[model samples]
Target: MSKLMIDSFRGFRSFELRCPGHVVLSGVPRAGRSDVISALARVLLPESRTSPTMSDLWQTTITAAATGDTEPGKDEESSDGQPPAAAQRLSSVEPRPYANVEVTLTDLDPELEQLFEGFLERCGPDGCAVAEDQALPGAPWCVRLAYRLVYDSDVEALEQFVYYPLASNPTAGKYTRVPASTRRVLPVVMLSAGRPLQLRAGSPLRRVIDELDPAAAAAAFDVLRSRVTHAAEELAGHDAVAQAVGVALASGGVGACLTDTPLDTAQVGFRADDGSAEALLKSLQPTVNLDAAGPLALASHGSTAAAMLGVAEAIMLATAPGAVILADDFGDQVDTANAEHLAARLRASAGQLWLSTRRPEVARAFDPEELVRLTRHGGERTWHRLKRPADRGRIRAMRQLHTQLLPALTSPAVAITEGPHDLVVYGTVDRQRLPGAAPLSAAGVRLVAAGTGQDGGIGEIPVVADLARSLGFRVIALIDRDKAEEQTIKQIEASCDVVVRLPSRTAIEGAVLAGVDIAKVRAASATLTAFLSQDPADGVPDVKVVEVVKRSLHKKSLHEPFLDALVEETKTPPPMIVDVLNHVAAAASPSYSGPAVIDIPPIPLPSAASPS
Candidate 1:
């Protein structure tokens, strides 16, 4: 899927979202993520019951309907050859604006490109055009399909259809409906919340049945259905069932004859499941029984989800060429480890995969470039895609995005720390300051470690800052007052909105340890030593106690316990230390006027400029 365009559809008045195949959408609740999934279903999957209702019509206004009292023009002819509704009402009704949802599909395999040859058009900087027109030569070709719902004045109801909208401005063009036969080539499967893979009707079994020779399957079904029905008939004809049914229906005074034409006969009998042979295939359910344990269902959700994914893959979706699978609230039911495992497998199963989730781990399963951030404010929705070059997650250098810094996708502001130790200290201080509220997380702030000034840790701040800003987040950099290089500090300043430095010339260790009483320091040191299972020596030298505290600060494994003890022993936090936390914590605003992150255009297709 190359692009999705929406206008006057659902909650979106006008929107455009373009991303490469296999995306992970993350956003706050009620941010229209589900609406996007619904839009895709309406256009691509006929099985989806997204029929347009009155509520689906979004552009009608009370004033427009009332003032259209004078608009009973000749264009008010009925859709058929009948009289229009406007001819009867005292005041004319204004036509509702058209609701259009269009999807542009590219990256077609060789066979599909041939199948949709007539519909293909090259889209480029000047816009889309056929080769004969010579307007879009050398541009990449794509096929655009859409669902349009329009209000019909004659019928006084909404009408909708999915069609090949083959025109530069899709709203114009002939109404060429995409027939059911052709739609099989572009099948869409929806996997949403509370819906795990099952073996019942509409499952993979049904799809496999449909793929078999239709006449052969129908013929076999006819014989099996007749045998089942005949057996049911025999049971009803038994002396017991007929007598019971007759007594149940017959009045006390009347004989058991039910029909006037037939003598001493009843009309009721058992009715087996009845439908066309083809339709019966859809009602068939497959069951699995393992050992003595009967199949109530798959043993667990993980097994069921995994089984379904395997079946979907077994169908060979890549062979279908244009199959699209949408997983809304993806991995909501699975555990973190399993969800990540499922995420990777899910991407490989289909030609295009679209997943949305509130869970951070599921989103992290894909590369950061595949992550799309969606936000809604003041009844408007926008989508943001990362602007980095198309690495497709191969470069493992950005591992922080896969772990500690993952929350930045949701945070409105982030405090980029110089090392892992700084995170624990700053995080503890933020928690202490907000005693009445939740920590930085509750306020939508993230404290991310840039690294320990080794292995591309501190130097990664500029990259991380750029990424956070690309997702519409504010960046605040926290570095040691003395240890950072002049060039490294300047690079961070250029990318981040705020840069905070400690007062001491040393790292956070010296800055946090300043102006503390010696006895209190020794007490904190004993807390660390006792926790480490070391025997206590009576009256250890004061200089040696300081050395123990400094050594613990350098090693990450020892920082947590010592820091917790120090925070507890020292009643008063240093004022300079508190100021650094203040700068990082200032990012959270209860009511946010969103940044212009939506202005980031989608990444263009390789060697092909975006169409106008």
Candidate 2:
């Protein structure tokens, strides 16, 4: 297993992703999914030939440079003692910020464990996890490798390096940079939309070929060289070649190198060297005939990419079994059928697998546990992972997640409620209170019921909270007071952006009624009774009015009229409803920096409007 920790890299700020054999990077477009994929690939991928510019630096890193917090590493003051240039000073700040992406390899196979022995360190079960409860089994032999870009204060340039995160000895000040030899042997295959798969130099496929056992084709290449050499000798003996050589020899200034050659030496010879043979082999590519068209380069971009996966499979089989494999925009050009095939292969791989795609079809192939959802919180990318099945509280919670799995992935925010009625109530309150704004949906929030609390456990409040957030959606767990006991509420708070508990153990209808004027409650009851063609009277006992509203809460005939009448009659919405509106407003706003834990104080709430 491999765990990824990316810091100040492009759009990501901080977090660890557990790469349990097959990890999938998924999120909406521009959500920074591909950024992580690139980081992971860049660390170990050889032929991924591209340079990262200063622009690749995290915003915070660049900002740190311009801020000029300290002197340059190397002094640039003129002989006359004048200050260094403003630009130089700006870029040469001490302790310059940089971006780093590290992958911790756990339980390394004997070979790699031996290869990286000098760089190895132990990561315990408790130490590696981002969260305590989520700690996984640690490896006795772990090797940590990282790709980093640090602003070089001396040269005022961003310098790149790949190194072991730990030093040979913990107390030693010097960390070891991976030798080019070591770096070349790192088995990784990174697939990207921009780089089509083929047997071209600097592509992933070429790297795999470069790593293959050359001895497999050594005899074939030798035979080809012998044939070419014999043919060259025959051609040199021809009358035409001899005449041309005779004409040039006497007049040629530098014929001395060939003049001493014997008849059997073949003065004019073809290049039959080993270097030529290797070059010929490297210049190969594959073509396929899927249609009536003859064998040709894959015409469609998606087809070309899909076909590349088969080559990637070859890397797994021969070049480097258990190689780190990653893809960006995985299903970009792939047809539906091909995309499904490729996605399923990625999902089932026993080796390290990572991919980023906005394609719903491709994304649906992996379990929630395999996904690392990248979301921007307060304008910085954050990674969230859902708990595996074994970690969930109840099966119902898992069912709740399975039901809205896709919508949660697409939506910007999700509200997890205690039951179906809670979903309706939360959305209704938002629309009713905000009128045209419809804050929840306007903010791209989708409401999903976590089920009622009466079903043995706290239901899906915790599950949906973790699931929705892991899908890169802002989560709001709005459940009844009973559903959110102290322990569960604390867990819910950890996952949800806004943890809103109802006023005491109040239900939605009760919470709403508490804020309505007593007169309005009685008035709405009278209006509802009159509409039902029954006793049309006012001043019903507040308790009786409460019963009337609860019955109408679901009854289609009177539900709308009663709620409408109550809305029109009541001047102020419930306090809890108002708080939810405010929270949604803040979350939906472009300036939302972080979670706002809005809990209506658990005080005695009036069951119904009672006083004048």
* TM-scores vs. true structure, each candidate: 0.72, 0.57
For model 2, residues 437-545, the per-residue Cα lDDT tens digits are: 5566667667777754344234457776765655667677775674356777778777777766666667666765665655676667667665665533344565576
Candidate 2 C-alpha error for residue 50, in Å: 4.1
**Span of ten consecutive residues with least summed lDDT in model 2:** 61-70
Clashing pairs in 2: 302-333, 418-451
Give each model's whole-structure lDDT: 0.64, 0.62
lDDT of 1 by residue, 467-571 (tens): 666665667777775556779877888887777666535566665566666666666767766556651322656555555566565653566666667678876
| Span of 10 residues, lowest total lDDT, candidate 1 | 596-605
RMSD of 2: 12.3
- True-structure RMSD, every candidate: 13.2, 12.3
